[model samples]
Target: MPLNKTLSVLLLSLISGGALAAEAGTAFIALPGKAMLADAVRLAATVTAIDPATRTLTLQGDNGQARQVVAGPEVRNFAQIKVGDRVEVRLLESLSLELKKGGAGVRTRVDSVEAARAEDGSAPAGALARSTTVLADVIKVDAKTHSIELKGVSRKLKLKIDNPEQLKQIQVGDQIKGTYIDALGISVTPQPAK
Candidate 1:
């Protein structure tokens, strides 16, 4: 499936039929010509309902909020998830941007995907990761508003910079190379024997 579609539904998949490794944190760093930001979320949602026919699972959060997520093709162990089973999901994402002061303004791209599943077949356990990188020109930078605009081959982005000092360090003639990464992991354990 498409990246956008996969990311949108993977949360529910990770909660219902999908499982994550359960790690959480958030951090940000900035330096000359380089900056990085990362975020992670860990969740434990109960499998409240399951529809084998439609391959859908309903999950309820601790706050009583509920969401239904359809198992995607990536979910090969859908049958392993059962109602009452505790599903833990961890989603981690990061973005890094580096400045190439006098780059050719040449655009480039790279993409990759990696995944693995449990070999023991004891329970559903897996991890999926994807990454993308692009080089874009600094088409515009408004120091007054602390905003910088980047233009790639197929897309353009205008982002606000919270730090004024960081915004004043770059100019429109430079190239900014950015990398975005996202990963999801899931772990499903059956209810304890009563």
Candidate 2:
């Protein structure tokens, strides 16, 4: 699937941000505010096999497990990777929510992407990162039930407010502005002279 589509699914699944918590190899950090969610995972795997023709690779993880992955068209420099090279994978995701007061009932979206590969052309390495932001209007706020509804990007979502006091402060016509980011980086390093 396209990155944008994958990101959309990820964002939708993450609408309930409380579930995005810490993992064994992942680090989760949030800002001082309660509305920010962030996490990162970094690992190093050995490239056990590679097939340039099929754009496929086999990676042996540190735990002695092997897994195969196929590179999609978005990976422009797949041919640069090599067996025995150490593949470092880093994944990161973050989401931040802010309340926009006295804003019009408008919905907006913004996105950005960045990527890079090994400059020498022979090293198997690449990185891709993307971010998305949405600004939506609050359509409903039910303090009795601590539920809120937001309309944005032509989609409506109903969410339960974690704090009843927070819900009481929010009002219809307010805005829920959210920023989400997802990034993946892969780098290959040649084996030392052995």
Residue-by-residue lDDT tens digits, candidate 1, 1-194 = 75335544666555553333344689999897789999988887778899999888787766566677777655667787889887777789999998888674698888988777555546866777989999989899997788999888888889888877778788888888889999877677787777
lDDT string for model 2 (87-137, tens) is 666678888887778684679999888766555545655667889999988
Those runs of model 1 whose alpha carbons end farther than 4 Å from true positions after fitting are 1-10, 13-25, 47-60, 63-84, 192-194
The candidate that achieves the highest lDDT relative to the unseen native structure: 1
Residue ranges of candidate 2 with Cα displaced over 4 Å? 1-34, 50-56, 70-82
Which run of 10 residues does model 2 get worst, by summed lDDT?
15-24
Clashes of each: 8, 0
Per-prediction TM-score = 0.70, 0.72
